[model samples]
Target: MADDAPRRDAALVALDWGTTTFRAWLLDGTGSVLDSVRTADGALTVSERTDSARARAAAFEATFAWLCRPWLDEHPGIPVLCAGMAGSNHGWAEAGYLDVPAELSGLADRLTVVPAGDSVVHIVPGLRDAGPDPDVMRGEEVQLVGALATAADRPETVVLPGTHSKWVRLDGDRVTGFTTAMTGELYGLLMRDSILARLATGEVGPKASAAFARGLEAEAAHGDERGLSALLFTARPLVLAGRLGSAEVADYVSGLLIGAEVRHALRGDPAAVVALCGPPSTEDRYRLALERGGVSVRIVEEDAAVHGLWRIALDAGLASLTPTATPASVLTAEEQPS
Candidate 1:
């Protein structure tokens, strides 16, 4: 079988390539998952050993090979679509960002090809804000599309939280702009690495204590722009007062990180509803804080990557999500930054 030879596009694959983990999902024509796998084969993970880009791509290919062997034994060839850091500046190859203030529909049919096991693999490029407060995303654009695809109505602001959190504002379906928040890493370090580590020893449970609420209060006062020291102060103040327990302090620390997001980086249209489409735990914390702050919000779904990839794969013509293809809409006139 040749690398570029056409085969029956019966199955679709989606890759959520990240900095540390490479996750792959097999999907049927209707965007349902058939199989999912993760490997220690991310960009930085692969970079530790080899200097060749081709070798790193091979690592991804080999990982996919193991998963697709059975499927290929029957079909011979299948198309895989990827999104996220896998297409970053240092990933397999650069698939550069599409300009932002664009709509979710803009990414519908877009695709980028990468080397795979004698088959075609497409990596989805992230969209970056072109105006001031420049921000970039490699894979979340498709996820955002999934969020909108099943949304109640056009969203005003969509917050996707992780290692690098994003607050994306949309004008109807087209994304107007966004900002990145380092909430995930900051929360992890402050809880485990910093002196604040003394407050907690392990994972936080479902029922967060009063310290969490207190931290949320202080963080709400300062919001996203507040410095690290100030946010951590809530932990110090509570513990010193003999109020927050070692375990309770962990919740406080968690709340501090999320509260800051609610306080800052969430400036969307006053009327736009907030869409929480990431981790449920963080979404829970964000919801409480934002509601308290008088922001109208909704929790869209748990696994945005899968939903986003589903829509992306279908649009890229890899998956049979749609039967009769519709032409891409003429882009709404681009908006100039003030």
Candidate 2:
């Protein structure tokens, strides 16, 4: 009788198809990841690398098949659930955007399915903020769905840190609104092109926690009329005056930028509970920034994309047609592996 229990087999393929990378995860009914795949076959790659109009039009499908060839050969006709830029206007196909203040369950209904040979591919739509100042997010919304679904508390702030960091406001299991900060992109420009570039040299590896802390403190205590622009000049002068050194400039700049973002996001209420998502490498830096601003942060695993795709697949009834899960199995790709 005990043996009669239904066996769980690998059910579906969860794909987080971004602008520069394509990541896949094999998941079971219980939402456990079985195996995974990652490739540089992203939306831009397909658009720029392919030759000819026919090839370019079929770029998404062709690149997908090439990357998942091995998996397709092994698993056969498993349904693929994709999220991120793959559904953007610049990707395989445009899935449009669902307005903010939307629920996770409703996201399934808006999925765009593209017939790809034997296996079907489903793309999750992005979210739009229909406010006075309009804004939109393509992929992070999927991760937001997954993060909110697993959270124990309601109405928590979720921060997805990257080239353009997103500060999302979740309320009653719905993503109410969000704001973006160009922290990472600015950091790159400063380190590569700005005056800070002169001294912010050397192999910048693991975060200089102490220097980062200093930056956070300085950013937090900054009381100036010029805002960040005025604050940035201090970096070079501190080095020349021996107040700050050359080697620590990068980390300090990172802290300053991240700290400024945190300070701005948590303005008016600094003690808010925040959930930090995305790559772990930047999580600690963000976590430190938030803490320095008197905010409490909970680090969410980077695999929220996998869970989000699975949940949407289930909601869209795509999971029902896929295979079943097999006992517990786990495999992972290093988040943002260098």
> How far does residue 4 in candidate 2 sit from its true spot (Å)?
12
Q: Supply the TM-score for candidate 2.
A: 0.84
lDDT of each: 0.72, 0.79
Tens digits of per-residue lDDT for model 1 on 170-267?
A: 88888888888888878877777877887676665554446667777777667546674676876776677887777677788877777766665544
- TM-score of every candidate: 0.83, 0.84
How well is each residue in 1-338 modelled by candidate 2, as lDDT tens digits? 36856755778888898866789888876778888898877777888865664566488888788777877778888888889888877677789998987776778998888878777898899889998978888888878878766777764688998777888887776787888888887987889998889887553445448888888788878834557777788889899999887888988888788878888778843546888987866878888777767777888888888878877888888785344534333423443224
Top TM-score hit = 2
Question: Which residue runs does candidate 1 get wrong by more than 4 Å?
Answer: 1-10, 38-42, 67-74, 206-209, 222-227, 233-237, 267-272, 322-338
Model 1 misses residue 42 by how many Å? Answer: 4.1
